[model samples]
Structures are given as structure tokens and as C-alpha cells.
Target: MDSSLYALVEDLRGVDAAQVLSHGVSSITVGAAYHRARDVTPHGRTRVTFRQDGIHFPPGDLFDGLRLLPPVQRDADQEPLKALRDQTRELGVPLHGWAVFLHSTTLGLAFPDVTQENCFGDRAAPADLCPSNPDVRAYAVALGRAVARQGMDSVVSESLHFGMFGHGYHHERSFVDLGSAAEFALGLCFCPHCQARLPGAETARTAASRLAASVLDGGPPATELPTVLEDYARSRTPIVTSLAADVADAVAAEGSSLTFLDLTGAVKGYADGRPTGGPAADSAWQIGVDPSAVSDVVPSYAILCYAHDEDRVAEDVAAYRTALGPDTTLRAVLRPGVPDTTSSDHLAAKVTAARKAGANTVDYYSYGLVPLPVLSRIPH
Candidate 1:
């Protein structure tokens, strides 16, 4: 869509969309809901009008717009890209591609070697992969490249981390290779390499073997964690680091430009005698940081929500700006339609707050969760 048309749309201008797309839009006004995390539905449904066509897409037709389908295996997944690219281009909106990195949903079938085990000696995870497996790393890199080749505007690695959930570290009975408690706190990989390496190489098998020997299995050996963590980071970072950098490289090769965003939770919040924490909007950045896990490779975090409290939106953004440094950008998600909240209009207010808090760019959920009318609350 052309900026003139987008302006027409923003101004409620009565103009032809067809004419505008053939041209280009000068600016954009994004319409979004508080959340796009819709629950399981038989088909994808976007609850509002797409700026591209202004057609209200039913759930069935929304999947492609959301990029939920798989890319063409042989075409480097670029087969169904024209429609997606055209629609986005017509709308003058940038895309944020979502990819579930280390965690794959293809268990019991594709790449089962990395699946985690349980006390029953059976695969415990549904389809999640172990982060430390080298093959798994390669798979992630390949998948990223595939997506990048498809011309995604920006890539967000959704779940690039250890297993989703499990119980006590059962070295002899579970699928995960456990490392020291510190490693666990800081994103432990625990594959054979990680475990064999205790601060670093203390895999479940090694830990059990050593523990069984009754040598007190004391402290993690010196030079163990730093060395192991560095290696772990190197191996793990490529999965994402490569994907992000690859997208940039791929776009550059084609003489195009794209942005790569990384998200994760670096700090923990204490409460209820338990350590609970929120995850990143991108999910993959939660881990031990090295230049690889996060580097110039990732430009910024696309969207961030504190989950516990949206009122803290400004504060969280402020903290990230300070800790990560101002040049590192952030996108703050706002939910103004909370059932009984009266503090402020959600999207616009949050956008304003983010700017005041030093955020230069922004992205938010669309239509269903947040309507276009919400823009009134945000002062342009």
C-alpha cells in the first residue's frame, strides 16, 4: 500500500487502495490489539481489517498473514512468499518473522536424537530438542537460513533454549543432562558435552558416574565453567546468531535490508518463596550471554511485556535502556483493555511512555486484542 493511501487510511481519506500500492506510502499508522497470542483454533483468524486490503480476514485465511505455515522445503521456503511480501508491501508495514529455534515440535519423527529422556527411560519432552546437541545446532542454523531466504523482514527466534519443563534433575532417569545449580540458573544446556565438561561438562551420566563413585563429587572443577560456557555459547549462538546474521547476509546479497531482533529475560523476580520470571517477547535470548548469544547480530528487542504489570512498562523499558544501553532499541507491548483497569488507554499511552522512556521504535499486537480506535489515546 502507498503512504498516500496509508495517510488516506489514517486520515479516513476516501482514496483508492489500488492506486496507492502502485505508488508508496510516506508514513504509517499501525492498528493493533493488546494481544495476538490467540488460542488454538482450527484455522488462523485475524480479528481486524488489514491495512494492506482493509478486508476483515476470517480465522481460516489469517494463517498466511501470520506466517504460521511451513516454508517450501525445496525452495528454501520462499515459494509462498510473493503473497506475503506483496500484502506487507502494499500495507507499508514491516514484518517480524517468528521461528521456534532450539525447541522443535518435530519429535517422534524428525530429529529425535536430541529429545529429552525421563525416569521411565522414555522421551519425556513432547518435541523439544536439547540445546547442547551439535546436530540440533546445525538444524537451527539451516532452518534460520531457510526462513531468511524467504525474505522475512525481521526474524524473531521464539524458543531457543533448554527443555520447556521437567522435574527433579534425575541424571540416571531423566532426558536432560544436569549441570551445577548456577548453570541451571543461567540457562544450562546439559547435553553429554555440557555435562561431561560439571561447571561445564557435568552431564547426567558423568555426574551419576562420579556421584556413584563416592568421591564427594564436590565443587565444579576450576577452568570448567568458563571454558564450557564459552564453548556452549559458541555452539548455541550459531543457531540464532547465524540465523540473524544470515538473514542480514541473505538480504544484503539480494540488495535488500532487514532487521534482526533478540529477546530474553536476564534477571529473576523473587516471590512466594519461589523464583519465578517472565520470558522475552522473542523467547530465545534467555541464557548465558556471549558475543554469540547477543552481538551486533541482533539489532534490538521487537516487543517487551512485563506480564506481571503493564504499568511497569515504562520502568522495564527504562531498565533495559540503561542496562543494555540506549542504542539498543526496544518495543513495549501495552494492554489498555484489561477488564477493570482505568489508568490509561493501552497502546497509544504505552507508545508515548516508551518514547519518554527512550525507546525509538515500537511494535504491538493487532486488531482483535487492540483496535484501531485505540490510536486516539496515543498522541501522534
Candidate 2:
């Protein structure tokens, strides 16, 4: 199960929240570090809550020498994680921490140099920190270690890969109709760090610039541009994989495992839960996530099986299972209601499908966001 600090501290309190969240799941993962969002918490103290982009705990010595430090959340003083940790301990339920890395508007705005710059030399996504940057890598490792230090069984790492252009900002406006290929081209980073790290970065940037320009001028989309961009995108695998390895090492040192959260399914299926094209795993490369590479480094993964159909969910999980191999632990994340699910039976079928497809664990999407009745749909 996934939850937030506000849900634990303000909504259900400590023990009550832990007991409520522990109902059908073996472990509970809370958002210890997250990006900015305004979510409607159906059962929360407030009908809606605005979450700031920052860590929920005090950094202390975690980021002592790091240039790209995490911003502390406004409610950090409440020590929600600490309280939940104690409560879960009493309930004998393992507590895990969910940390969003490399996707913070606060840090990106504060240190523009660390953000991703596109082919046009403009900041592509102000909220996305280029993973190729040394400081960003260090910060990610430190953040993982910090979360692990809270006595978590594992740290579920989200947004560890590159951000897409369509979902980078809130209320993002684009009057011009940039096609998927154009958006992909514009989202590529040509910053100094990416240029220094990726091979043939200059050539890729030039191709990307021309492709984006052509699309903007209503010209025919170049067939070769996406292929070039994809080749360039493959070059980012090492950077993200190595970063995951670093974070895994850091978390392991603190006696906790790292679960790499791949949001490809969510990107494809979040709205209506009917994702088209190839399996989510096949498209993961576009976001710098090479499942095989990442799985080799991090033994555990959390795949967002956000689709509604059981067959679709199974297919997505099966692809990830093949990519990750049988040795790695695969956790399938599902939504209990709305966009993805319509009833308890619908949710249960997806869960069973995921497990049969090689998911060792089936975790629900959220605690506060979904209604209590919807949460009850989780297979025990």
C-alpha cells in the first residue's frame, strides 16, 4: 500500500492510520520524499492537500557536502515517518519509504544549472534534474541512504528516470500541436553534463533540433529522427542504471533494499487505463529505463500495472518479468478504482493476473486518494 505523511499525521493519526493501512497488505510504503502535487484525500482531515516538493524528514548529516540538496517539507517537524515507523513496528508490518528522485521543481528552480536543457538550449523541464549531473547522482544516493536510515525495509524509488515533456509541469500550456515525436525530441537533454556523458551527443542534438523544427513548421515527421533519438536515448541507460546501482548500494549499506519504480505503465494508462502500442516495458527505454540493465543492478522492481484489462496488466507484467528475469523481485502496482478498476472483481482479476505473470507482490496504488470502499478491493 502507498500513503502520504498527511494521511498518517493529519488524517488517521498514527496507530489508527497504520492499522487501517495494514488491513490487506503485508507492507506499507509511505511517501517520505516526494515532488509537488495537490491531491484529493477522500478520508483525510482535509478534503484536499497540497504537497510541497521536498523530503519529509530532517536531512541532518545526509546532505552535508552535496551541492544539490533536497528541500525539507513544511511538515517535517511533525516527524510523520517516525511516528508511522513506530506504529508499524508495533503492528508487525514492514514499513517502506517511497522517495521521488530527480523530479523536483524546488531544486530545479534553485539550481537551474542542474536541470535538463534541450536541443534549443532552453530548459526542457524545470522540474527535471539531469541524471547525468554528478551532483544529482550524489543527491540521489544520499536521499536513498537518508530514507533507509529511517529503518525502512526497502526504499521504492520513483521518478529516478527522465521526465517526459507532456507531464513535466502543472497546467502545462502548448498552443502549438507538437506531435509525440516532436515532444520526445524536445524532451532530450543537450546540457553540458549529458553532452559530456552521452556518445555522439552533438549529432543527436542536431538531428533532434531539426526534427522538432520540422514538426513545429507542420512539415512531415522525419522517420529517421525518432530512431536517432531512440539511439541517443539508449545511451542514457548506463547513466540511470549506474545511478540506480549507487542508490542500491547506499540503501543496502543502511540495511534496506531498493525497489526501482518504473512509471511507464502509468504514463500509458493512468487516464483511461487502456494503453496502446507495445508493452510498457518496450517503451521504458524512452525514459532512460533499460529494465534489464536496471534489474541487473537493483534486484527488486515496482512496475505500475495501471491498465484496466487483466490481459493488458498480465502482458505488461509478463514483459517486465522477462526483462527483469526470474531472479529479480517484481512488485505490480495497481489502482483499486476509477480509471483502472470498476469493481472489486475487476481489481481482483488484475491482481491474480499480475501474480501469475510473475509479480511476487501486488501492491495497491494509494491509501488517501482512493475511497475506503475502493481500497477494500485490494486482494488480501
Highest TM-score model number: 2
Candidate 1 structure, TM-score to reference: 0.54
Q: Which ten contiguous residues of candidate 1 have the minimum total lDDT?
A: 1-10
Q: Which residues of candidate 1, in runs, are more than 4 Å off? A: 1-81, 107-109, 116-123, 166-188, 196-199, 203-286, 289-293, 308-311, 335-344, 366-380
In the range 1-380, model 1's lDDT, one tens digit per residue, is 11111121222223233332332222332211011122221111433322221111112222233312222222222323334446567766653344545443433134455654321234545345564555555544444444444454544454444443332122225323344433332233444534433343434334433332232245432223344334444444444454455545544554333333333432232121111333232224334233223435555554343233434555556655654555554554433333212343454566566667766665432223333343233333
The 10 consecutive residues of candidate 2 with the worst lDDT sum are 1-10
Question: What C-alpha lDDT values do all the predictions have?
Answer: 0.38, 0.84
Task: Estimate the TM-score of every prediction.
Answer: 0.54, 0.95
Q: Give the TM-score of candidate 2.
A: 0.95
Positional deviation of residue 9's Cα in model 1 after best superposition, in angstroms: 23
lDDT of 2 by residue, 50-153 (tens): 77898888887989989988999777888888887887799777888899999999899888888999899998588989899999999999999999998988
